[model samples]
Target: MNALTVNLRSVLELTDEQFFQLCQANRDLRFERTATGELIIMPPTGGETGNRNARITQQVMNWTDADGTGIAFDSSTCFKLPNGADRSPDAAWIQLARWNALTEAEKEKFPPICPDFVIELLSPSDSLKVAQEKMKEYIENGVRLGFLINRKSRQVMIYRQGKEVEVLESPATVSGEEVLNGFVLNLAMIW
Candidate 1:
């Protein structure tokens, strides 16, 4: 089934705590809030998509483990963006110091901060335009670098702060560049 968006724009916005409760009440579903307070209910990905997502997160987390400069998160970890949207990228990273600055309570809920680096893998059900726009939103919300990987087309879109998006076609691997400090994403499993 396709994902659904429910508009709650006319009503009072849900507080972060209220949103958390709503999510808790619906444990099996993935929920997200748009800046304007629309509730997004995402469908679970297909088996192949799930496998690719796992490999993508694994590679990124491995890099974070070795680099020791940041913490990595899989798709389930949501962040309350500065623009008021709650977003969960496919794979995300935050610098160690920045993550450490949050209080335990803040960390427990959707952390009210953007990730330093974000990646979105385009599944068959996802719209390429929407995914690219989400990547742009991450960049706008203070993420230093973002990657939009499309396995079907074998194209990857690189988004960097203050720079034009760089697109790579049929790339076997992608560099994390200065933002990730020498980490490289081997796209073999993902592709």
Candidate 2:
């Protein structure tokens, strides 16, 4: 299903705590906040999408465990971006130093720092244009590397800071490059 965006700036402005409480109350639903204060309600992904997402997250988690240089986060974790937007990427990783910098209280709420690496897998109901825009926003907010994987199209759009996006079509695998050290994502399971 497509995401629904609601502009509640006039009726009510949700503070950070209010938004967090709202999310906690609605445990089954996923929500996001735009930089402009709009609310986004995202529907749950289908079984196929969920399965693929699990594989992707598992790979990243394994890498993080072995690399010992960063922490991996699943899709359910929302981050409070530098630009005031609350976003949740499919799979994300933050450097150890950056994560250690946050106070215990800061870690209790939505993280206030952008991830060092992010992955957004396009599901059947996802919009490619919208996903691309989100990737750009991640880079602009200090993400070092990102992958927008469109499984239907078998295309992976690589996003890096200060560089043009690179598109790879039907690739067997995608490397994490220097960002994740020796990490490489195998596409066989995803495809």
- Candidate 1 lDDT over 1-191, as tens digits, reads 66698987687678989999989899899998888788999899999889999998999999999999999999999899999999989999999999999999999999999999999989898988888888888999999999999999999999999999999999988999888988899998988
Question: Local distance difference test, per candidate?
Answer: 0.92, 0.96
Q: TM-score of model 2 relative to the true fold? A: 0.99
What's the residue-level lDDT of 76 in candidate 2? Answer: 98
Q: What is the C-alpha RMSD of each candidate to the true structure, in Å?
A: 1.0, 0.6
Cα TM-score per model: 0.97, 0.99
lDDT tens digits, residues 81-102, model 2?
9999999999999999999999
How displaced is residue 133 in candidate 2, in Å?
A: 0.6
**lDDT, model 1, position 73:** 97
Q: Count the backbone clashes (under 3 Å) in each candidate.
A: 0, 0
Model 1, residue 69: what's the lDDT? 94
